[model samples]
Target chain A: MHTETPFKTHFNAEQAGLESLNIKSSNITFVSVSDMLALINQYGVEQLMLGMVEYLEADFKRWLDFDKSPRFAAHSAEGVIELMPVADHQQFSFKYVNGHPKNTKIGLQTVTAFGVLSDVASGYPLMLSEMTILTALRTAATSAMMAKYLAPKQSKTLAMIGCGAQSEFQILAFKAILGVTHVRLYDIEPNATKKCFNNLQSYSKENDLNIEICHSSEEVIKEADIITTCTADKRNATILKSDMVGEGVHINAIGGDCPGKTELDAALLNRSDVFVEYEPQTRIEGDIQQLPSDSKVTEMYQVILGEKSGRTHDAQLTIFDGVGFALEDYSALRFIFELIKQNKEAQQIELLASPEDPRNLFGLTQTHSTPSA
Target chain B: MHTETPFKTHFNAEQAGLESLNIKSSNITFVSVSDMLALINQYGVEQLMLGMVEYLEADFKRWLDFDKSPRFAAHSAEGVIELMPVADHQQFSFKYVNGHPKNTKIGLQTVTAFGVLSDVASGYPLMLSEMTILTALRTAATSAMMAKYLAPKQSKTLAMIGCGAQSEFQILAFKAILGVTHVRLYDIEPNATKKCFNNLQSYSKENDLNIEICHSSEEVIKEADIITTCTADKRNATILKSDMVGEGVHINAIGGDCPGKTELDAALLNRSDVFVEYEPQTRIEGDIQQLPSDSKVTEMYQVILGEKSGRTHDAQLTIFDGVGFALEDYSALRFIFELIKQNKEAQQIELLASPEDPRNLFGLTQTHSTPSA
Candidate 1:
């Protein structure tokens, strides 16, 4: 059902005549923002997130197979732009993401991202996708996935401390993944809380979820079984204090994802067991940056592999200091790539130049000249 | 005359009603392979290379202002994929490129690339372009730009070894930028040499340039004032020995760009005064990789900035061991971004998601719900 695009058509026409050469097409599948939303609409968001969590769990189980490195970041006065790349034996993926705390002040997203998935053998990109929405989905899915192993058993209350762009997704993921029945929302700006409460109205009604709006962090965390702190301040602000959090609570701290940005009080971290996605990256960008370099933390991959313990007792406080890892993006991209393959409406773009004769790249620019046989 | 696409239209309609918020559009300009070819056809290939050389030289002159790093590479048994990222104060650009020497056996190009350029202020991408063709152009422009500084006075003959995809572009860049009047070509495969010769026929005839084909590296290097080695072998087979290269000849060695790949003999690198684009990168990937790590080599930026000398005497052999740098890609991306801005046929793709209220990213996914302002 794919359209006859130039990149595919040219290569296919040449391939039909020269099947012995085993030519590969250079067309790249592109999933725009609209396309992503349509896919979410086609397959429910809950189903997509469940699929993504499966992929994330599967990838994390084989974590040793990946070639992982810390992201390459370019820091500026305004914000940071980063490239996060990871690879397995068969596929390679990378995400280009930017974070500017002041972007919302000017009516822009605080974070935006795009990514590519490629074949390892041919080294040609198989898919290029917009990751703004996908990133939100994956981040929330990751937090919820970790919560499956770290959150208190039979937990039903989720406290969302920052009602920003990521607030609703976090609530949905918890509700869908962990059977969360109640959401307590708080934000510094009342309008933000009102906006998030309004956005979740239909989802809460349809899913039998009870939602409450609170005025302060202390009020929000009163009966929260899981607390998610995602404030967008670029400094070390204590969104949660030592005495504010109770035992048997899980904290997913995601917003403090840069060098100088952090959220939890140091005393709070000292009193709790912390888990992170990738230790090397979390040390520099996660909420645990306030802690010493040798601070005790467990990597979630180890927990998933049954190599390490997770949430040992009912009274234990667990914090997931997630700065987001490249492997999650790889899983997300791979999941979406499979979804788009079955989607007849998927769009393909001519991102690479493929000539009939690979050696005759210059011949592509020659409109009037043909390749010499 | 841009089209009224969904991304631009939605953002623009929202932006007009909320101009006080200073909303920016999320549309990314896309230059497909057809667009790149059209651009080369619109502006002559020689002229584009000349313009690109000016940018390469200007960016190299202000080298310290840039944030430079070695490419992040993921190597496999067959090939490697790399991400080269570099940024200055105002803009950031990164190229995603792959090199697979065995790709041609299956009818794929040995190398293919694409890149993105973004604004540092907003951390939003401004353009996305197909860069397989662009990389070839920039590599040639960078080589010729360096030759302008190190080639001997009144240099005319350019002996090109390994006439593959990059051969004609190098010939054109040298002819346009350095005023080379004659070219001698040699390749291990006769068809490659024949293809390059046929490709350059019209340009050579129109530019008053004489071109000849030689069977051996030694025969091609005779009477040569500048030699460029761009063979595609991924091993340490020497394309040029010390005895083959004559005095007063500058060599632009570009093919040996990985750890195990070396095109020039060790004795040849030892005999020449090596100049490199970036010393740390070249020490691992360029022809200078064959030399000792402590071997003295001048960075081309220092020479361009007048901090060091270049081509001191007629008999001095100067080799520009170029592994290609991110700065050259940055300059080429910047140059093309400007060009596409003026070209009306430039395509725009929806590579980002933009909601009216930045904090209400979830509102974009909810098709039936209206924002409760």
Candidate 2:
């Protein structure tokens, strides 16, 4: 068993009495990619997603308490880099993420991210975690949590239109949260579908879940209770046409989250009862960007809070146009912070400056005598 | 001499042949407070600030190339946390900073910060650094750099009001960049003034710089060539009355930042020729916030580019109302990135995820077989 590292020891000491210990010992818990994988191994991916859904649902219910804004994005010729920040009364969190579709050609992930969680009172960061994997987890958890209130009851089949990096996570989240046992996958590249199918072999057998591969999106969603479109095109390419989506199917559109990027046909969006993570942001980056500015759409928080209707009838078409909100990242960071508290050996990094005398910041430089000529 | 760690090795290998190397080996250069102190000790604070001034001047000249926006702020009862992001065509940078005045009461610094520098082409972060110390350095360097263009020629004395954490850095920056040899300090708390005076003893002695402490802000500014106000009060209290300021003095007013927090009297602001960094932001957060929204003020970049006048004559009252722009942080991070390249032993952290197959993100969890019950 791993001994209590300074990360946990300091946290425990602080919890005992924040004023007793030297605040200099307060360091940020750092969750690397390897740490995240270790965590997933410690608790299965399905269980983590199940845990995350509760957080997502709880945070969404109190959405009005959060300070929300559209992400700050710096778009270049290649892609975009964005900073998403949201905070409640006690804690503040922000995620630094980037999207470059062309990165995979050079053997890099299309989207990579990291984030910080901080205390609102003292303004000191509590944790810094690798968010690429966590983002995939949270995105899926959010989708499945939304579908719990919006999808058909006991939804058993999910059709994933983009069988890329996010396909497996989406399938597992639906399985863990909504009892989705059948997954149908399709992609523009057949290799993506093959990879998705190959990855799920062991889990599918163990959990008694059925998996199938289809050559076309139309064929994939033929009887799917829920359809997920997550293609990575940087332009307004309609991967799902209005005629392809069947009645009463909840569409989970996750990709097409940038200004010029979208996945669903505008006509399909017009016909469905659209729900979004945050209206101001989704108006610019979500599939609703293709619709008129004044088009009718419901913010998902209202549905979660029981202020608005989610699934009015079995025949009503519901579409979740999630552009990804900052509040979800805040909840994910908050959840991970709690998990690390229980796991003693989580890594910590010296990310902040803690001078013995807080006001004498200049004294830190005088510690070493030798100065370079 | 320390050996080349995996950080520099991977960076070099990527530079030599980006397409040939596995991009998974790339990691972010992590500069802790200790690392920053090591850097300051190695090169000396004066030399580092001098080098930073050159970068600041060069960047300010080409300011139009940057994608700039007002910082995103989350304000609470205790304080505010802000994300300041700016990017050029090739590089992107942002700083995460918070200011809680009451933090010092609990033995925490009033302000703490960290930031990320990234490649705009790939949207991958290149470096992550502790900005608490660097922010002090950058803030001083920006003030002195502006004083170079705006201050009266060959000024010798600097009077600093509120001799707290930033006092010593401001004094050194003036000494190194503008050749100021005399200093006068005053603070509301006499102990803060004593602390500042004690900290600067060795540097003053070594460089033959004269130092004085005054009981009142009025006495401190007497015959001063430059006056700097940097009190940390969170309210609009006038530390400098208009009648107290004299002509031919360059005023560096930095404490009067944020919406309701200010230090200079409105009459003093009305009497001075104010120059600022990034006008849109200054209009909300700088000392100029006391003035009307349409009040005339010069953006400093234009002066650096020689498009506008700086100091017209010796008797003119000029003020650099700097609220700390994102561009300065960009320049500071860029400078540190270059410095760490020469110092091979700089620390690195695994802040980003790099799966072997970018599309097979699910495969990462499979590396460890046993799942918790």
Candidate 3:
């Protein structure tokens, strides 16, 4: 019942015999954190964000083509670690990510991640890359892409409610993708807002963006075309109150992604037309988790697919509950895979044994034996 | 509520300040296939198998402590790619493995895998290793460990039905751990049998084992003390019939793992008392899948834990429906992790970003920028 594709019909190796276990070409590309930064810097963050948006949009437009599921999460008192897996016909991708809110207090990351992309034909990993930086880049691109569909056409200002690790990326992505020129930043801690403002000073000048630090969420909540909430707090904090939000504004709610972790008040969700990444996952992990299970919410794919309308009226309040999904990570990893193919600095590692004789795996240990120190 | 341990309490780096993004200490150890083979060769296959047997037994004895689930599988037209994850309080491990029975025809392995072991406390990967060899080692160890309890006293002969890649490892492990000095090898493909025999020739001489090649399964079925069936056919092919079997023999069924795949006949399963790894998964994927949904079976853990008896009578037929589980991979990865810690040959890769100020992930990318090629 299965027809062989050209890639699967024949062996690409020079030694096309089962006994030739010498791996001339490795299937896995290992991109470290430094290498990933180099690759992204080579392309430039603005260009990378634009490219990611295209991939994200492409995947979302054909949402039915991908297998989607709520990530399997293992929760502890300290934090949560999750495995998010998704696959299409040709390839499969998964990310191992953790959200440890208390990590920063001990000089550790509140979030860190790595991912692998494998060919569905052979099940060998094509690439393994550090997803810490990639996740930040993709998360911003997803927000901006959603805002492009939901926000008003001439949206120029972004109210960044929490200016932390992800804030600068969000600001830059908005400027690059959505033509957002002004950003009003706010954080509970003044030092955090200051750090974000100082770090973005050169980028803001280079991109011709007006970046200002606001004293409070209310100070910028009413005056912005788009509001992005990305606070790192583990609790349900109302970063944006219902009464403070203005009409015709697009809310890019990025925080409150896990259960019992929310940024928007329940009343705010009730007041806005909610759109989500995936309904089942978003209902459990997004700000919509605070709302009723039967609540009406439009899937963002429906808008991208042109099946549902986004921001029907100029005065409408639109909310994209941006709980990051596996598809976005897949898009990011796929983008990295393409970016590093021509770049020689992308390291290759022999993650699987290719023996001359497939059955003589034990013989390799004898022949290729390295004296242990 | 959490007390800090010595490892978690202090920064072991010379640069203690958050501003020092320089990472002089790395937590990740990257053990490639060659390194894995070197390590295994250093420890000797028999000793490594013996060590894995201990780890496997310990893990199985405390099986209830593990968070177990049926592997998350992504099935395609060509094959299956699966992620098997397991975690206890201290460590978490998962393997990315693929099974394509037709891969050997194109000079590729039918099964190839890699895995990661991470610290549950920090949620960072501690070790990443090629598990193609490790899986073979672990599978053989687990079988031998089970045979230690299930096989008759002083069992000497192992009848290997299918001489595939894993056949040699099984023979060696049984010889080392269970003192099975005689092996009867049989395969429909004579080349496979030849390859297995040639690979075991030197090891057989060193270990004083009597290795003989058999033409058919029936030739050695009734004479052997332990019969191991590990054919590669994807469909149900009855390699062992009930009428051909003898009394008081232990059956190690490995190949009939996936759905619609069976090596032994249904009548044989009905006549034998089956023992399985993880009852829930075995019911769906093991040889028991051919039997009734509510068939009486014993869990391997129960036998190891003394909750259930193994080989009740002298004439009873004992079947071990061995559908590989995630815990075995965990044990193998853990064993590799300990073996490579003091070995300088084991390379370490920075698979994760360990910025001094964990919150300033964007800043690290900016400062550690590599010039674009």
Candidate 4:
């Protein structure tokens, strides 16, 4: 007899939960935003980011393992809500993410998200966790991961155009992973800049990095080592124009991720060595949306796989048109799940009912039942 | 002054202390199979069905009020999982559902589900509820509502193939609205037939009707006034061949709602008057998949909106080829929300976290401090 409980009967947010509930029961797991943030803080942002990068790379390597689509987006005046679903043989995941730049006005984050990880075999949800914070971590890490491949080895200074909720993470990630030392920040709202400045002041001390607050996009981007534009809103706002570009500046375009939304000018994309997380998605949602059909852009995975060069040269302008991918979510989730495992401090929330007999679904109400022969 | 809550907070099965926590907080309401059954029995199936029917009509009449897509489905060897999303001005709703026939032998229901309802403008989740029981109610109510419009004036003698979990609800719903006095059951598994027979026998007394169990699919199909094929599986099995169908039959083809999974044959679809919940989705998932691009299938909404005819004569063969719609789930959530409002017996689950200042997302974990300007 086996000493270990058959994971088949044991239902936790275990790694095996995906295979069992996905194929075996109508089981679903739920993790909310508060719990997710707690998990992130417990895990330490460095490990979380690194883990996400690794998982993202693994998924991208087996790119053929996924059943993917470009994502279905419903756009509004303030922002957009998108559904990104991708699946492989054993597992499937989809994200419900909203990008409302104006949500902060009413005391809400610009992006609020959640996701489901289900079994490809049974289609039962194995886990559900808050992706809002995870999305930020993953998005920032993904950008940093790309910059690691595409930016100069000694890159130190970073210019941030959008100093909102995402600004702190983007700067910190680059500093942690890319050896970035100095960060220059700019935002349309001075209060947003002040918030980012204060947040980064503490983060900089913890990470041992120097930071500066700038008044204009030109001031931030002028002779920058690497530039990151994470501006919000559903507009074709060109915070970074080609005219202001300096040589060898790697652009991490993070905010413009839906149709009719972009942070860079068309001329800038035409002039840079453009790379994307998912080419199909980027063509519609990334900075490439401003470019022509014949414009060339490399898929980021190719660079990661070593099939192609990243920046190619120190003097080249490398643009990582980051439009947030499902792989990033998968990586972030795997990281969080691992953190939850290592630190048993995080509360385990339950959202699925384990039926005594899965088939007698109606018996869920009945406390006692006799199974018919 | 208005005092009612403007938003509905959502909780998952795991958070509500259910079996699984594989869901994120957002526009998703994850009801474990157990939660759904609990809601159904507590609210009583009759109240739920009637409530859903009322919402269905309201939604259907304001048909253009939704951001509707036919549906997007992904099929695998074990089964199929589908994403059905719809949005109105005020709210948006989507359901994640799957069908796997082999699940029962391994200990699982053939279908399992969870859904999300959100505010379209705010991009925030209003409510999340277990929809498995609600799905059963909505599915049956949708069929009954369609029968009210499409079936002959006096519809009785409903023959149900595959008398599993769904058949009980289907029979009861038809009995309630369509005055379906006669029901004949058939399933490959005699246990399923016995279960359905026993369940409906008890139900018929309350509804004032009669229920019968038959061994052969063809015998029941031949005499049935309304033939309902609710078989569970992936293979393209023909529960009723064209030869078995009678002239005046209203066929509710519920089982065939996936790409590789179907029940009624191509010949049956061609000979009968086919009506679908959504034409584009039905063309791919319904028995109509066996038909051609030019296949003339009528939208059920058209008949309801008076743009198309239902049954012109008693002898006309009618088929309500329902593959479940987002609008139906929309109606289900709406019905449940209304039910919880009217009846104090409804249980309230906590799914979302309240942070005083959303920007201090990190402060959610620490002692509260006023956000600095």
Candidate 5:
């Protein structure tokens, strides 16, 4: 209802035609959190995850085509707010996300994000979306994509180390992308495990997945072919040790993203063949931030592009160090934009000004004649 | 209407109280182009200009409190899109703007802009607004603020070079701020001059001022006290030369923004004492881009802060290099946010998501029981 009709009744045909060609109508599609939820319901999570992974893989293959930059962060005492902007020749995308570990204590989300995709030609925003849910999906998809190349061929069971906000998403993505059937879940807090169990119990029954809630992380680690560590701690606490991680298992380490916040022991990271989304950003924010600056790591795009070897030996351990790059958000935005294009129910709101004569910008607001001194 | 009421019928008393404490209501005040126009119509331009100047001065005086960076720009064959971000401890702001000089040929705006202001604590956006009209007003206010300090105190008449989209705002700003009673306008295209003449003819009559449309820039340049050059060409243009400028005449060079886009001759710059906002950024985008890297320039903030002098002598030629900065947009956004706060009619839309339990983001969109592969 908020959208302005392209052809207004007041405009003459020539004026309407001219206005239609301008492409500066000052409106952008706005997808609220509820709208995104509705989209997921309509399309189904498996379908959305599968579609998102396809876009992510396609974008990652052409990594060099994108204008990539580390997120510009404004760190404060409480949290950090970042702007991650990336562009291709035709489109530009940016995500505004925050990381605040203590927000959960006060019943606020620890992480919340929103993003915009604009046309490069006019720099006019085409879509504005709630990215909190989308980020969870993309992060899970990125992990699954990495596991597809690096995990052992017969991998079927996943070890979910944290069982926090992103645990269900990771499980769902693995199921959709890798055909993963079994999941072993563990969390330091028993209530977190209960929440995860309550949320995904119906999912497990419907999908024919063997979901087990384990008593300890070690119990789950022994059975997992793929290990995903997504703890919410803000310190360098070792949730996985070098000895505990088995050979041939692919480790998806996501929770250890900020500097000084890592999940794996240094000894474990030193032993594994680590792959990263972007080396420059991962070195500073990923689990490898605990490693020495000169530590060797493989870029994930190279593996995807077939320039580097993946899972060379049956017993070799692989680690996917994901700090969440800007390009992944770009891919997610592109995916959602495509969906919105197909669905007319995606609501839009006016955000820009399109004056009939761009030169008469002030005339858009007619002025008062009394020039009071 | 897009805004979500925090207390839905489903919420219990405790949940409603908790939701009230957390300000993540998914609603953000949005000011559209039409809304901004209505605001101006209600408040009057002179009043808005005066208030904006006050906010601009207040922000400039405490310049060190802000985090400043050169705008991040993406250039193409046609034009450029830029992201300018700035923040303090409590709040963050960014502007997405594009400059496409050829756009007007196709009935599109040569420049379009929008911006966001968010709370730094939670990283939630507070407002989204159409910035094209706001930018025009703020640019004119900044020029007027500079002219008050740099121009001769007793100056009256004004000469406006290259009458375009921003010309009327500049004239009105001078009239409101400096009590300038006369304006002489010139442009390469006679139609542009005619448009300017028509727009301000009623304004001149209301304020009892002399308004002249000259055939050439020379006719206006000879008798003006303050000269403002605001051409829209995207190349190095000599709209004003050294011999044409007189003693004690203040020069407001605004059109010469962005690299390789300038209006004044290098010789004219060489003869005047140049003042700039943010030296490092001005070196790349302003008229001073033609000068040496180590060229002596006074920071406008220093002049505002009383750390440096302004307009030393009656015959001194002073130039205020008016390259728009992120902080000016910040000031503009702050001003608009205040007005919206006072008046609820300034419509806001839901741009973020708020759930009963922040951790259950996926729960917002309830998934189907059957997970089809």
Candidate 6:
């Protein structure tokens, strides 16, 4: 199957589709930030959260069947840029993400991302979607997925320790998947809390959920069923100390990703039961970085696969230390790729060149009409 | 700066180009296989070889400035797919390549590749290019550059082993750079010999180059000044025995690039002075795989910088065991990306959707005609 076209064979490289079965142009489906807000509004965050949870459960069950590779990371003084790649026998997906903590200083979000979904056989990229919004949606959905399997039944209150762009997504996901009716929010910046408070007011009315912005992280974490810290600082910030974290309080640590950029105090990690996406990667990138090399933390796959206990007791402090996995982005890309493929409103952009003669790709320059994916 | 546009911007993703800077939009350039063939015929192979060598040499000298990430690879029962990433402070490039020997049975090239050049600052893919044909060109050009620094000054003839798609480029590169006038070819398949012979018949007139089809490998090895093994077999064939190798011959070993794939005898490595692209990678991928880990080998950069010897003795056999490096692709991409930019053939590809309102990504679906970054 790996022969160069006999120069004369009508095997145009540009015309090759993602399927590789025949040459069809690729359709790059794009989702901008604004479109994402509209999508969330139309379906409602509750429905989006539910959709994501179901997708993650299905994707995780087939984890071993997929082709997984270590992410490609470029380290800078300020942050890191990474490309995470994953594929099964058919679909290939990769996410481009950056963790520049200084971005907020310049009026930009701390992280931004986009992704591609392609066919493994043809190697044609089928979708190029903006993933900044999708990432927020998926991360929240992942947290809720963990809560469904591990959190105590009838969990209803959540203490959100850092209310930012991702905080609302987290709140909505919990409300949708875990039936958390109330959220107590806290942020370093007072305006950030106001923004979360004002933005979530409409969501509160629609879902009949209650949200209160708190003055301190300690006050929010005092008596909640779940605690989520999504701080964006580059330095090691102890947003949640051991004393603040109570029993049976699931800690959804979101921001402590890179080395030396942890959020939770090491004291809390020692007392809590930890779960990670991928052990090898999480060891270097998750809140588990605070723990020893030989620390006994279960891979989330084990929990998903039912090989290990998630919450041993109703009073255990369970920490879902998520440091985003390639697999989650893999599932998200496929979900959106399939979503847009079925919907007529999802516009298709031509990104790959599919010519009549793969060998005669030079003839495209002579044409007046521009081709899309 | 990352704000999404109120309108949409578009471009092809898989077409070829490299990272280019612009204040407004991301400029992406492309070169398909036919365009390369067109350029090859128009400029002639000599000029393309010369330009590639000049560009490759420039990038090789500034090697320390690059942020080099080791290539990520995924192996399978049938073949392997690898992602090679490298970047200087200004430009970044990555190539996706797959090696499957059995692919020939289905009429596909054993190795097929495409790549993107992106800007580090904005996180935009500026160019996507077809690298299959360009890979052949760069591989040949890299060989020529090696011979220029390593080969004997009075080299006249080259032994062509395992004549394939790469055979023509290698021969032409040698002719253009080393003034090699004669090539004696050998391949196990008679059909391959016929293909190589027929392809280069047109080049014979321009340079008065002589090509002889030989019956055995020994026949070609005895008289040639350089020997290039561009074979496709995945096994350790030991095509060139230690005893058959002559003195002062510069061996360009290109085909024995993966683990378990080698063309040279182990004894030949002990007898010949071995030089590699990157020692860490070559240890696992090159002909030196036959040798022990501690066995000393010089880096090509050291030889280029004159910190180590290339050919210390007239009688010593010198080998350039090249498993293609990311730097070569970086240089090749820079050259092509610049070419399209200068010729005004490149266009801005809207890859990342940076909206006016970073928080409103969900509103993009309703505004289909809206512009974004």
For every candidate, C-alpha RMSD to the true structure in Å: 7.4, 5.4, 7.0, 7.2, 8.1, 8.6
TM-score for each candidate, following the candidate numbering: 0.93, 0.94, 0.92, 0.89, 0.90, 0.84
Give the B-chain TM-score of model 1: 0.92
Q: Candidate 2's chain A scores what TM-score?
A: 0.93
Give the clashing residue pairs of candidate 5, or none: none
Sorted on lDDT, best first, the list reads: 1, 2, 3, 5, 6, 4
Clashes of each: 0, 0, 6, 29, 0, 61
* Stretches > 4 Å off in candidate 3: A1-24, A371-373, B1-27, B371-373
All DockQ scores? 0.40, 0.49, 0.46, 0.28, 0.29, 0.14
Greater-DockQ candidate between 5 and 6: 5
For residues A1-373, what per-residue lDDT tens digits would candidate 3 score against the true structure? 0112112112212221223222324447888877888866667677788887877887888799888889887776678778999998777999999898887887778788899987777767788898988999999999998998999878989999887778889988888888987899898889888888888888788768898888988886657999999998888888888988878999999997999899998998999999999999998899999998999899989999999999888999999999999999988887777667657666777788888777667777777566322
Task: Note the residue pairs that clash in candidate 1.
Answer: none
Full ranking by TM-score: 2, 1, 3, 5, 4, 6
After superposition, candidate 4 runs with Cα above 4 Å error: A1-28, A342-357, A365-373, B1-35, B342-373
Candidate 1's residue-wise lDDT over A246-320, tens digit each? 899999989888899999999999999999999999999998888889999999999999999998999999999
lDDT tens digits, residue span A1-373, model 6: 1112122212122432343333254334655544555565556556766766666877787778777655778776666778888877766778878776665554444577777775555455566666777898899999989887777667888888777668878887888778888889899888778777877787689778888878988788766888888988877889888887768878889888877778999999999888888777788877888789889888777788898889878888888888888889877876665555445676554444443433223233234443112
**Model 1, native contacts kept:** 0.62
List where candidate 5 sits over 4 angstroms from the true fold: A1-22, A367-373, B1-22, B367-373
Query: Can you rank all candidates by DockQ, best first?
Result: 2, 3, 1, 5, 4, 6
Model 3, range B62-132, lDDT digits (tens) per residue?
79988888888888888888889888766788999988887777777889999988766667677888898
Overall local distance difference test of candidate 3: 0.82
Question: What is candidate 4's lDDT per residue for B209-228, written digit by digit as tens?
Answer: 77777889867665578888
Count residue pairs with overlapping backbones in model 5.
Answer: 0
TM-score of chain A of each: 0.92, 0.93, 0.92, 0.88, 0.91, 0.89
For lDDT, candidate 4 versus 6, the one ahead is: 6
Task: State the weakest 10-residue window (summed lDDT) of model 1 chain B.
Answer: B1-10
Query: Model 4's lDDT to the true fold?
Result: 0.71
Model with the higher lDDT, candidate 3 or 5:
3
